[model samples]
Target: MELVKEIFQHLNGWGLTAILFIVGILEFSFGLYKKWKLNDKLVDLASILFGKLLMPVLVSYFALQLLPKVAPEYKEIFNWVPFWWGFFIICIADDLTQYWYHRLHHEIPWLWKFHRTHHSAPYMGMAMASRQGFFYTLLFPQTYVTTTLVFLGLGVPALIARGVKGLITMMAHSSIKWDKPFYDNKWLHPIAWVMERTISTPATHHAHHAAHDRDGIGHYNGNYGNMFFLWDVIFGTAKITRQYPEEYGLEEYQDDSWYSQVLYPLVKSDKPGSELAE
Candidate 1:
């Protein structure tokens, strides 16, 4: 346990990159061999490259310049607290910021264009974490917030938050559906409901990836919560469909190469009806 705790201390900027790399590799391999979902592969690869490689570095650069002035008292606060309290604050703030950014992705057209790459995947797995568009992470508020926290002398806690959030979000998107067996047990409903309402579950997150508004749709526009579903309930965006999607991915997507998906937003394609063609 001591060594395990020490490894967590080493997880900062580059550490996050390494962690994401291992996760992306495991998910990609599973997605290719067992799940073998072609449409999802492009999305997985794009998200990893953009979210992991470009976004954090850019956010940290800007955050470092601002944090010294914005939250100079952070170290003082850190000094006063027990370590776990600081850790909890970073984790909660990180997720709260992510919840809004995620909700915005569904409502804003420009943001939707980027976020759709994630919804474009027909299947969910660990790789689903990597299903974002190139440059998409630049607009993510959570990335900025996490970076700011780090620069404010809450760096270790921010890393801890990232690791915890990653585990929750990735598990929620994983192909393994964990809710089914629990459902038939009458004893579990109250506990499950409380947990689901407070935090995200596979049932809720999978519903976001759903394709349409029909019974099969899983109510995609709602359930915009990240680690905590309560954010949705509090904000009036929560959807409570306990069912998973019969079908997934954008209803209108046509196959495009990885190049087009990554570059079109920046390059502006001429392809007819392309998302960026206009």
Candidate 2:
């Protein structure tokens, strides 16, 4: 456990950046770079700068400070629990919270405005993974859950689970389509079945980002899992087609500026019909 924590601590700063660059290069090499627009790049850059990097650090700092005052005695309460057990608890709590959080973002009108930026991208890639509204990132439920768990002495396992989740999310959003081969090969079908059920895969996640659902391949309302697909399965929101969508993004999208996309409601858009407009 100590070794895992040490390794993650060493790589934490550069890991996400490295993954983005690597997957971005692969997307470029495969000629999918043309699919990206200038606005898309700008939104993605803003999201990475604000949502992934700046906001998380700021939130974590506040969480750390505030948690102690609210419940100091609860600190490291789960430290004595077995490592695997702790990890299991985190997987269930963090992922399930995220599942509902994500589902609600689509089901509710006000919440959808904040989450709209994520699905605004016309294409899927490593960059789009970070394309979220600033406030949406700030109030992410999993962040609070994970932060509280860490305060309760589940730091090491929580970090490890976070690392694993990060990797899965990055791949799930990447244009590389890593899960395709598993569905294609006859012998790998068994492994693929288990994998698709166990975790979010490119096919399953892309379906969620699909612009429309009339095609049967796109499932914008379902497959709301983050780290684990089990939550979706158990909750009856799972959709697995082993197929990719022809198009992505919102069915009815407004051409809101990058600023409005990232900092909506706080920084309203000048566009007359935009949801972010006053």
Candidate 3:
């Protein structure tokens, strides 16, 4: 267990980066890069640099500092638990919490402002996966939960689970459409049925990014699962279209500056009548 914790402390960030890089290559090869506008590129670049890379470190630092001071007795409380048990705990606690957190961002008006930047992109690809508002990235429930779990002595299994979740999330957002084959081939339909019910896939997640639900393929209000699709199914928010949306992003949008999108409220958009302007 000590060895596993040591390895994760060294490799967590690097492992995530390697996954992101590989997915980026696939996106580029598949021509998803052509769909990106200048603003999209700007937001993506900032998100990769700050949102995914810098923010996690800052959050972890603060969490580690604050947790010990506030709850010293709770530190390493779950260290004795077996790895598989810890992994299962994260899958339910972290993933299910994220599902509700994501769903609330759309259903609640105030939170939507923070999460809207993620849905601003007009395409589905790895680049848009991390295009989140600065505060949104920092305040994400999963981030706090995962960090807390590690502090509770589940570091090794938590890191492994996080890596698995990251891979699934990147694939779901990528333009590769890997799930399409399962939907297209009759022999593979059975696998799609089981897979879509278990974890998120490109088809299920892209529908959540659709501009509107009028297209019959879009389910903007549903399919909020980040890692596990089972949460959506259990909570009655699941939508399995087995198809991609014709368009992505909001039905109504303003040409807000990338700065405002990444660092909103701190840097309001100059565009008149924009959400960030307020």
Candidate 4:
């Protein structure tokens, strides 16, 4: 635990990228070896990695540079905040912001052009987590939030929160499905209830990735909560079937090139049936 704390404190920006890359690649490989669904969307996976690499750094830089100028009076909150409280606040805020952006990406046609890359995968995995459109990262609020917190000298705590969040997200997206045993435990009902309400579980998040489209568009891409389900629960967007989707991926979309997925928001696809081209 002490070593973990030390590493968290010492973790550099570049180091975070390296960790995500290594872990992501491993997850990608796991999906490939297991023949997990969506194996054909490797290009989409690569695009997500590129977005994570470039967009976070670019936005974080600008956010850090501009935060003080925009919210100078909030210096006390940013500077002298308690470490744990600041960590919790930032993490919750980050997830809440992400939930909104994710929902909007699905609801708004233009943003969906970029977010479609994520849903393009026919199956879920940690690697799939990175498979987002190039512009998707540009508009991600969490990156800017991290940047602001880092500039405020809360970088360590912010990174720690992100790392913890990433770990959960990665596990939640894994094909392995860790929640099965817990969910099946007859005596674990109370704990399961609390866990599902408090943090995102595989069952909860996977349901978001379900690939159907009715008022129940189980797969139409609406639910977008990250760490917490409360945002969805409170905002009237929560879905709680606790069942995984049998089929995944966009309902009826084109199989565009990875390049198209990366550049679609800016370049726009001209192909018929293409989300952006349409």
Candidate 5:
């Protein structure tokens, strides 16, 4: 347990950068990004890694700064929480919170603009995985949850939960069909059954990105899980197709600029019909 904690403790910026780059390489090798335009490249690659990467760091920095003032008595106060218990608590709390947060963005009318950038891409890959409006990242509840847990000295489980969630969400958003074999092999059906319901996968998640929602395959209204599909299943939002969508992204909002996608209210889209438009 100590060793695992130490390892995750060292998964710094460079390590995360290497992982995203490697995943980008995979998506490129798979030719998933063959149709990418310059704007697509800029929105997906140029800023995703750095802009999204700073999200957590900035949250942590600001959180740490304010925590000392607001809750100085609670500094490392939760250090006594057992590692496994902390893991379970954070795992359930963080993911469940996100499941609702994501669901609300899709279900609520006005909130959709904050999340529209993520669905603007015509394809899925490591690039799109981090593509989101600035306010979305800024207001993510899990960012505060995990950062608070870490500051309170549940750092080990907090980091593990975060890393695991990241890897799951990344794989779920990836263009690579790594989960294909699980559904293809006859003997693997049972494993596939549990795996699909246990964690987010390309098949389940890609369906969420389907352009048309009522095509018997798409479920843009559901499948809101990130790390754990179990939340969707339990909350009655899960959708499984075992098939990739023919087209990805939104059918309505097209040609939104990179700056508009990332900058949101700070930089609305020029398109009068866009959700980001003033």
Candidate 6:
């Protein structure tokens, strides 16, 4: 168990970055990124830097400042927890929280603009995985939950759960379409059936990024799971077609500038009729 924890920490630190980099390169090499506009490029770059680098540093700083003054005794407090049990608890808590946070952003009309940047890209790719507004990423509930759990002595399981969830969600957002093999092969249907419901797959997640839900393949209103699809299934938001959407992103309002998309209310879009426009 200790060995597993170390491996997860290492993987989350390096393996996550490596996989996203390699896959991103593949997408570029395959011309999958040819359609990416400059606006999309800037938004993705800022989002990756903010979400990956700054968010962690800020979160750690927050934990350090808050924990010492309020709950010094709680630091590493849950270290006594058995690893697997801790993993199970964090696995359910983190992803389930993300599921709701993600769902609410779409269902709530007022909150939609905050998350609209994520669904503005016209294609499916790794860079778009974290292309959320600054405030949207900052306010993600699961991130704080995981950070708090780590401070509370569940670092091992929290990190493991985070690492595993990170890999699943990122791959699901990649342009590689790796899940197609499962649907193409007859022998894998049973496995695919259980797996699709168990975790977020490219098909299911991509459907949520569809430009319009007019097509039967698109289900942008639902399929809000981040790591686990079980939340969507249990909550009646799941949709599995074993197929990718023909068109990704929003059907309208594609002209939102990168600054407006990333900065949001602090810098609303100048484009008239844009969702980000005040």
RMSD of each: 3.8, 3.0, 3.7, 3.8, 3.0, 2.8
TM-scores of the models, in the order given: 0.80, 0.93, 0.92, 0.81, 0.92, 0.95
Candidate 3: regions farther than 4 A off: 1-11
Q: Give lDDT per model, in order.
A: 0.69, 0.85, 0.86, 0.69, 0.83, 0.88
Better of 5 and 6 by lDDT: 6
Candidate 1 residue 93 Cα shift, in angstroms, is: 2.3
Ranking by lDDT: 6, 3, 2, 5, 1, 4
Q: Over all chains combined, what TM-score does candidate 2 have?
A: 0.93
Model 6 stretches with alpha carbons more than 4 Å out: 1-9
Tens digit of lDDT per residue, candidate 5, span 18-72?
Answer: 6667889988987888767777777776457656567658886767687788888
Residue range 92-150, candidate 3, lDDT tens digits: 88998889889999899989999899888888888889888888887888888888988
Candidate 5's C-alpha runs over 4 A off are 1-13, 46-53
Determine the backbone clash count of candidate 5.
Answer: 0
Top lDDT prediction, candidate number: 6
lDDT of 4 by residue, 1-278 (tens): 67455555544444444555665577666654353434345655566667756765677558656677887765445667778987887788789889888888788887777788777677776567777767776677787767777776676678778877766666666655667776789798788877777677777777777666453537345456777777877887777665677767766653676667777656766567776665
Worst 10 residues of 5 by lDDT: 6-15
**Clashes by residue pair, model 4:** 210-219, 211-219, 212-219, 213-217, 214-217
lDDT of 1 by residue, 1-278 (tens): 66445545555545444555565577666553354456556656766777766775777668766666766666444545556877888877888888878778789987777776677676676666666667666667777766766665676666667776765676677666667566668899888778778877878888888777687548778888777788888988778767778777767754555555665567654557867665
| TM-score, prediction 6 | 0.95
Cα error, residue 150 of model 3, in Å, equals 1.1
Using TM-score, rank the candidates from best to worst: 6, 2, 3, 5, 4, 1
lDDT computed for candidate 1: 0.69
The residue-level lDDT of candidate 4 at 126 comes to 59
Q: Model 1 — which ten-residue stretch has the worst lDDT?
A: 11-20
Model 5 residue 55 lDDT score: 68
